[model samples]
Target: MGLLAAFTHTLEITLPVFLMVFLGLGLKRLGWIDAHFITTASMLVFKVTMPALLFLSIIQADLGRALQPDLIGYFIGYTAISFFLAWAWAIWRHPRVERGIFTQGAFRANNGIVGLALAAGQYGDYGLSVGGVLAGAVIVIYNVFSVFILSLYSDEVDTDFRSLIKNLARNPLILSVVFAIPVALSGIELSGWVMTSGGYLAGMSLPLGLICIGGTLSVTAFKRSSTIALDASLWKLVWVPLFGVLGALAAGIQGPALGIIFLYLGCPGAAASFVMAKAFKSNDKLAANIIVITTFASMFTLSFGLFVLKWLDLV
Candidate 1:
């Protein structure tokens, strides 16, 4: 594809996904939704619909193709490296209390929400299948890393390993993937009614989650943005994805795999980071700012990155 064609192709994939976000923003501004709605809807998507979506996707996937050991391994290694790099930067530049928040903001991507949505947009069921399995690893790694980092800097936060493990054990998202894996591997078929019902609920997850994300975007947060927040946003939207995509190419990952990696890596800071920061008694406002800035900025960065990938026919 030529430059213009590549970009247009990219937009065709990305625009619908992002427009839901804008719709939510517009709805929120119009007094059609409030904080309570966002909070409740977020919880519903996180706990219920999203899990259903993941389970169905994984269970229906070609386990042999979807369970790419190399891709999963690369994601694990890349995430670990990125976490430590962000942590090291935070410790060097931020105060003791704020170090954890900054580090989390810098390295964590909204993979489960925005990233998965984009992946599905770009690659359809194949994307969701791969992205679903990948999300399982993401949930485990991000939670464990976030908990460890937050605990290191906060006396108020519990640092117990058992608690972390327990939380992860109960996470619906992780549990969904865990259960679906053996089923997919064993070729266990579910009833059509079950699949259909699950599909309806699953279908609601991404759009609802993206809308909540849009509603959660606060202009007030943008106004409160600090240098630290901007720095973290840069890392989230630019540096992390840049290094990650390069590493994937170096490893000979191409086509949809490389594209999926880029989309997930290029996602904005996780909304969970803000909650974790608050729980840890760190700079939550700064965390919020980073989320706002990165989320808004990613509209352009993700498009350009994907366009380049398409232009080069790498994905």
Candidate 2:
């Protein structure tokens, strides 16, 4: 496609995803939904709907063809490097209380929700298949690092490795990917009703997650954390993707693998960052502010990134 056509296509996919966020914001403002509903919905999407989406994506994929070893290696390596770099930067620059929050915001992405939606939007099932694998891998790294870093900076100095392992084992997304891989490898064709039901659940994941994201955004936190929020937003949305895509290209990554990496890199700081911050007694407000700003900023960055990628025929 021409640049103009690619740009249009990019917008076509992204605008609706963002529109749901705005719709969610509007609904919350109009009192159609409140904090309780948003929290509940977010949990439901995270625990149930997103797992269904991942399961469907993986179970239906031809993993022998779709799962690229190089791509997986690159994703895991890039995430590990990014996590340590962000953590090192935080330790070097920030005060004790804010270090974990800043580090988490810098490297953690809302991949399962925002990243998957954008991938599916641009490339349909192929995108979801590739993106789901990447998400499953990256989320494991994300959770492990998040717990470690938060624990490092937390007032409670003792880190529970066992609990972390249990949480990782029990993670719905991780479980979905694990369970689906065996079935996918076995070439067992699910019943039509099973496929239909999975599709239905998968379809609900993105829209519901987007709305919850919108609903949870807090305008009040902006003023208090504007500087840090903007800084984190730039790191999350701009620098991360810029360096990531460049490094991936340098390493000869291309096609859907490259596209999935770009999508994950450009995704906003996850809302789960705030949850982690709160749980660890780090700077929760700062984490929330970073999420809010990065999310709003990503609508532009992600669309532009996709347009550029499309123009270059990289995705």
Candidate 3:
């Protein structure tokens, strides 16, 4: 595609995904939904719909082809390096209390929703298959890293090793992927009705999650942007993606693998960062600010990045 066509294609994929978020914001402002609804719906997405999505997608995928060891290894490495680098940056520039929240914001991303959507849009079935497999790794690594960092900075958050293990064991997202992999590898064929019902639930994940994200966004948070929040947002959108894509290129990753990495890494600060911050008695407002800023800014940066990649024929 030409440069204009590449950018237009990028928009065509991203705009619809982001529009749901805007719609959520609009509904919230109109009082059609409130905080209670966002909380309930977000819980539903996290505990139910998203797990269904992951389970069904992984079970249906050709795992032998979809599971790329090199890609998974690279992603995990990139995420770890980014996590510690962000932590170091936070320690250097932010107050002690805000460091963990800022660090998580800088590296954690809404990969399951935004990244998956864009990857599917760009690469179709191949994208979904590969992205789904990659998501298994993403979920485990992101949560572990987030909890570890948050606990380091927050006295309120439980630093117990057993508690962390228990939470990870109970995490629906992680369990869904864990269960699905064996079934997938064994080539178990599910019944038609089961597939149909699962498909319905799976279809609800991204849109519902996007809307919840939009509903969670706070105008007050955006207005309250501090240097800490702004810097973290910058790291989330700009620095993280730059280093990730560059590393992918240097490592000779190309096509869909490179594209998927770029998309996932480039995703905005996850809305969950705010929730975790609040739960850990960290600076939730700063977390919210980072989410708001990165969420808004990503509409441009993600598009531009994809456009350049397309123009260069790198993905």
What TM-score does structure 1 among the candidates reach? Answer: 0.98
Encode model 1's per-residue lDDT on 184-277: one tens digit a residue. Answer: 8888889999999999999999999999999999999898889889888898989999999999999999999999999999998899998988
Candidate 2 Cα lDDT to native:
0.87
Count of clashes, each model = 0, 0, 0
lDDT of 3 by residue, 1-315 (tens): 797888888888889988998999999999999999989998998898888988887787778768889999999899999999999998888899888998999999988788887887888777777887787678878888888889899977787778778988998887888899999898889999999999999899889888888898888889889998889999999999999999999999998789999999999988778878887888888888999999999998998898889889999
The pairs that clash in candidate 1 are none
Q: Best-fitting candidate, measured by lDDT? A: 1
State candidate 2's TM-score. Answer: 0.96
As for lDDT, the candidate ahead, 2 or 3, is 3
lDDT of 3 at 213: 88
Error of 1 at 49 (Å): 0.4
lDDT of each: 0.92, 0.87, 0.88
lDDT digits (tens) for residues 1-315 of candidate 2: 798899999899889889998889899999999999998888888898999999999888878755888888988898888878877776776777777788889999998988898888877888888888888888889988988888988886568889989999999999998899898999999999988988898888999999998998877776666666677778889888898999999999888778888988999888889988888877788899999888888999999998999999998
Model 2, total clashes? 0
